[model samples]
Target chain A: MGAEFVQFSLTPVLIGVLSAIACALPGNFLILRRQALIGDAISHVVLPGIVVAFLLTGMISAVPMLLGAAGAALVAVVLIEAVKRLGNIEPGAAMGAIFTSMFAAGVLILEQTDTSSVHLDVEHALMGNLESLVWLRAEGWHSLLDPSMLATLPGELSRIAAVCAFVVVATLMFWRWLKIATFDEGFAQALGIPSTALGLGLVVVAAIAAVAAFDAVGSIIVIAMFICPPAAARLMTNRLGHQVVWSAVFATLSAVLGYVLAGYGPFWFGFEGAVSAAGMIATVSGIILAGACVFGPHRSRVGVAQQEAR
Target chain B: MSRMAQPTIATDHGHSIDPARAPRDTALAIHGLTVSYGEKPAVFSVDAAFKAKGMSAIVGPNGAGKSTLLKAALGVIPRLSGEVYVFGETIRDARARVAYVPQSASVDWDFPTTVMDVVQMGLYRKVGLLGRLSGPVRAQARECLDRVGMADFANRQIGQLSGGQQQRVFLARALAQDADLYLLDEPFAGVDAATERAIIGVLKSLKDEGKAVVAVHHDLATVRDYFDHVFLINVRRIAEGPVETTFTTEHLQATYGGRLAATHLDELAVADGAR
Candidate 1:
């Protein structure tokens, strides 16, 4: 069992955890600012950005993918703004309209470009192929220590780790500003803080996170960690710093537990094979959110009404 | 009132404010201000000037653009055409010296923030971006909260507070700003008698220190008792001067567009007794 784990499970689990932390670190701010849905939009919108970049460059590289993702997110923002201004509608309506259209644009671009020669398709875009990421070329766990296993690691794992590192550094460096801006934008503006630019910077970072995580876990975990863990953490605490920590814990828990259940739970159900680990991880996070809603220390709707009655 | 009266001068910006006093004394000046939605104007040609040493209330009926006038001046909303000057400089140039307290209803009380966190934001400009909150900044924030009787609730989540307590927290935040001029939207709305008294005392102290206090007020009975000056607004400036003179029954009727709602004298007595 230990040998099999070392051979087949190590890299996939690592990828899942890295992407979860990467997405959830910035997810706290998105939930705080009530812009969580923007992540879902960006995750879908990056499709066309990646496809177009592939067509133009004729090569698949990390830098162009990052740029394409960021550019598509910018277009989504502009389209959302246009809908908000011209239609005189609420923000939720604008986001819904723009996200769908941009995602459809991505599909059309991929179809027209005919890049099927590569191992890329729409199905693999929405739901990632986590089982394929492997560093099992090593003979044993001892080989993982050698320079060969370390040097020949999967690019997906390295890409996610770099993105995760950037997220951690950027979040820590600008922690105070992000907190203030998320809590009260008007107050931030009155104090001469460049809130607009800061907001844009956050969205760009979120785009980068979504883009990087898309390949390993696909869009499911990206959209889930963007909103679910932060929201669940919000139900657990009243402080922003604590909320961030709690959200990371929840995301990591989802990744780890989901991997275990996906690999082993089918036997309990009388099946011999494992399931989709990425989807299972996203499902675990959803279950955690539901658990927080019922059992967290914070007052729920029923709790508030009971207090009023007392 | 006559000592400060001057002809309404139309500047090139089309503002019809009274520029008679020394330019240094005016606290806020709005020139040729017009805000429109599509083709309809919400506020049209609003030109009024406030002084630095008095409590001025923008009084008008519901939908009379009382809040609109203040919001437009602060540039919180879009202004199709106009200039807003604070201390003889454009609002953009004098932003740090000015503070605004939006309506309580506009805020999300359920937001996960402590009273101290909210108050500390007022001093963030002083700390600038990337600066940490030092001991002195936190101390000053506590002092502001103490002034409004919310010092005990510094660490308390804002969502758990009562409506009146929430309003007081916002006031403490504005106090922490320590700005030379303050614009408040309905500070008295939804607040209890004690919070109202505390707020009025704070505003009075601001006036005594020669700072400008422009507020959106609704209770007609307390107009004379609470404010030194009044601006009767109804999509445009109907009248502007000391509350004793500009708050006449004639001006009130015109500003309300003859659709006066019935209010009892007991509310006026409450406003008086609270003070």
Candidate 2:
């Protein structure tokens, strides 16, 4: 019975953790570069890409969704760049103008296309149904090693894992270039480091993470993890490495705690079923950020201690 | 007609450089360098060159394109038309040997990075991809920090440092590069007097080591004392030569234009005269 419980509940939890870590990994760079909104923009714009891919392929696989989302993200980025360049406007204005149009276009695509046949729907895209993914094909923990159980393992977990691994390897491998370019771009350029290439690589990584999170969680959860954990971690530590580590911890905690609260909290309140797990996770991360902003080690204490001194 | 490039009559002194002294002796060369901002020109046909060794100050009043000239010459900004040669070669070849410290205001100080992290950036090209800061490379970074007296603050986040300290840390980062030529934009701006002195000391040391140093300096008062060579700029080269000979009252008048007589500009002229 214990083994069955572990086998039954592990997939959803693993999916949540993997998605959170993936979102948080790239979130650090986005926050550091002050391009946090780009993450939000990418997450929103990817909706149309997924819907379009569904229309074209007539199936909801990982590759097509990722490809469509990546394609849309690339277009969004290119349009943002073009808007900034041709109009000579700030990146913020360009991001707003382009991303909104892409998101609206996505909604239009969803309305026009017969998307009822696809397993994914607008609601699932917004705040994924994590509860529906916990159906274990095997009865015991031994099923993890069983070929049939392994084959039937929840697809979302492995997809999130692949994207998470890519984020980790890329972050570690290109860490030096990212650090230099982010802190002092002119110096990095003068040193002949490919700052422009590094910047684009970061954007692509963010898009990949957004797409990965979109399946098990949603764009809302993706945006929250992309900005909140990194931002909260920023307020908590002076060192960037520590900030990244803290961000990962905060993101994982929000996912774990949020999933449990979402699955079980309604029972205590006498409500039927439960709330959206993605929504709950985002809310928890938001709360964690607020707490950090007010009580984190590097933040607020300076002002409070000064008042005491006076 | 003065824009004419004569092989023999190099503008080193009062119109006589030995013909045998090749143009290769020139550390940096900017020929017909012009920078435009849309319809208007910021710096026009600005021609100046620095020798292989010694400290030269690019001196001018506000809006004189002193910073613009550096940017255009280094290809940091788009030039309307210009050719910059470093050590008789293009900037691309001499990139690894050149270090630039932009105006301190250009940097975002609140960036989450340590002083050591910034210093390590200087070695990016030398280390290349997949190279870690292990053994002697780490020691080199420390030595560079020690030179700027920012060794103790190596682990400290850069945002917490003072303006002068930040400037010193920038200098340390450039020092870690161990480059042959240095271009600095107002390193002394808003720095404490001690920092100014220390920065001047470092510039002189670099000069002593036969490394070319060019700084965009605002204070004309210390031109003769601090720099061996000076380029008096106001959209164009007003004058360029040994500070004692070329930095005259007329050049200051030309650089400042109408702002010379009515303001404290005359004080800088008088200070140089007293020196």
- Best prediction by DockQ: 2
Candidate 2 segments whose C-alpha is farther than 4 A from its true place: A1-8, A300-310, B1-23, B36-39, B262-266, B270-275
Please give, for residues A1-310, the per-residue lDDT of candidate 2 as tens digits: 4665556567777788888889898889887888989999999999999888888898888789889988999999999999998888999999999888998998888988787776676788788877666746767777778787788887888789999999999999998888888887777777777788899999999999898888778888999999989999988887778889999999999999898889789997999898888899999999999999888987753454355447
Instruction: Report the TM-score of the second chain of model 1 against its true counterpart.
Output: 0.87
lDDT of 1 by residue, A193-235 (tens): 6778898889888888898998678888899988888889988
Query: B256, model 1: CA deviation in Å?
Result: 1.6
User: Residue-wise lDDT of candidate 1 within B20-127, one digit each (tens)?
Assistant: 432646888888789876677878998989987789999887887888788778776679998787876666667788887888887667777788988887886678
Listed per model, the TM-scores of chain A against the true chain A are 0.92, 0.94
Go through the candidates in order and give the clash count of each: 1, 0
TM-score of the second chain for every model: 0.87, 0.88
Cα displacement (Å) at residue A275, model 1: 1.3
